[model samples]
Target: MSLVVTATGTEVGKTVVSALLLARYRQASYWKPVASGACEGSDSETVQRLAPEGTRILEEGYSFDPPVSPHLAARWAGESIEVERLVPKGRESGLVIEGIGGVMVPLRDDGVLFLDLLVQWGQPCLLVASSQLGTLNHTLLSLAALRAQRVPVAGVVLNGPPNRDNREAIERFGEVEVIAELPVLDPLNRSTVTQAASGFDTAGQLAGLLDQSQGECR
Candidate 1:
């Protein structure tokens, strides 16, 4: 089974949660379709570094240093970000694809949305929403959009500071399962990711979310 990891917006802990999920599985393939604002030393590089063992890094079509939306970033680079160009690794050991920006971000001027690719690939999405204030709206809106488009949503994972009230509201109001709650990490270092990985009850909470026996496909 392939899982698409996306957030309400950029830097909402999508990569961090992705890393943690990867670690929970111990082994999987990762893909970042359209990365933007990646300088010489950037979070994308850090993500690549934090990937668990045996995680094959899939090729990305667009990597921009502008740290902005892919459309504008690609425009600056005299190109365009098109999700159709991304080569699918074909459900090998469960692919985890991370989107470049938020849901509505345009990949090309032709009005192609990033979510379209996730739908085309037919991977159940794992929504990663920040635990900060105003997350309820973001989370709900994202859920509504996905539902409207007939996209398969696996579940939601709340990241960053743990707000018990907000978390409870999301589960009740959004009507989606909360797969995990990742607290804010001090220094926000890679070790925190490792610690989270070690503690995840993968075989329990997340097991049902994962495709256990893609036997012949794998």
Candidate 2:
């Protein structure tokens, strides 16, 4: 089964979560459909660097140098990211796709949202949400959108400091399990990420969820 990691907004540690998830499985392909703000050496480069050995790169297209929303970035680059060209390819490799922006960000003039691409890929999603205040709305809204699109969500992985009330409410009320909670570190800092990569505990958490979901499917 494939898994896509997404957030309510940008800068919510999606790449970090993607790397951790990639470390979990063998031969998992990592694909970022559209990326913006490509420096010579940046987070996208870091993602390629930190991916485990034998990992297959399915598809990646970096648009341009604007650190803005994908729609604006694509427009700035004078070319749009076509949805037709963005689907997964090759054999039945398990995937971990990371989105460029938030869930509702537009990809084309015809109103193709990012979530549309996720639905096309047809994978159980692992939402990476912030654990700070206001996360409840962000998490629930994202879940609502996913449900509206009929996407099967595996569970949510809160990607910042853990909040007891937030987690409980999302579980009890939202009815979606909180699979894992990862703490936030210094902004753009790779130290905690390096440690997490070396330790690789998120793999167990993700694997546990995948096993549970698969059994349910059977």
Task: Give the number of the best model, judged by TM-score.
Answer: 1
Worst 10 residues of 2 by lDDT: 209-218
**Clash count, one per candidate:** 1, 0
Q: How many backbone clashes does candidate 1 have?
A: 1
TM-score list, all predictions: 0.88, 0.82
How does candidate 2 score on lDDT?
0.71
Clashes of 2: 0
lDDT values of the candidates? 0.75, 0.71
lDDT of 1 by residue, 1-218 (tens): 67788888887988887777676665566778788878745544666667565556776667888878787888899997656678666656667778766777788777888878767877788889998898999999998888888888878888877789888898999888877888887756556777777665443555434554421211
| RMSD to true structure for each model, in Å | 3.4, 4.4
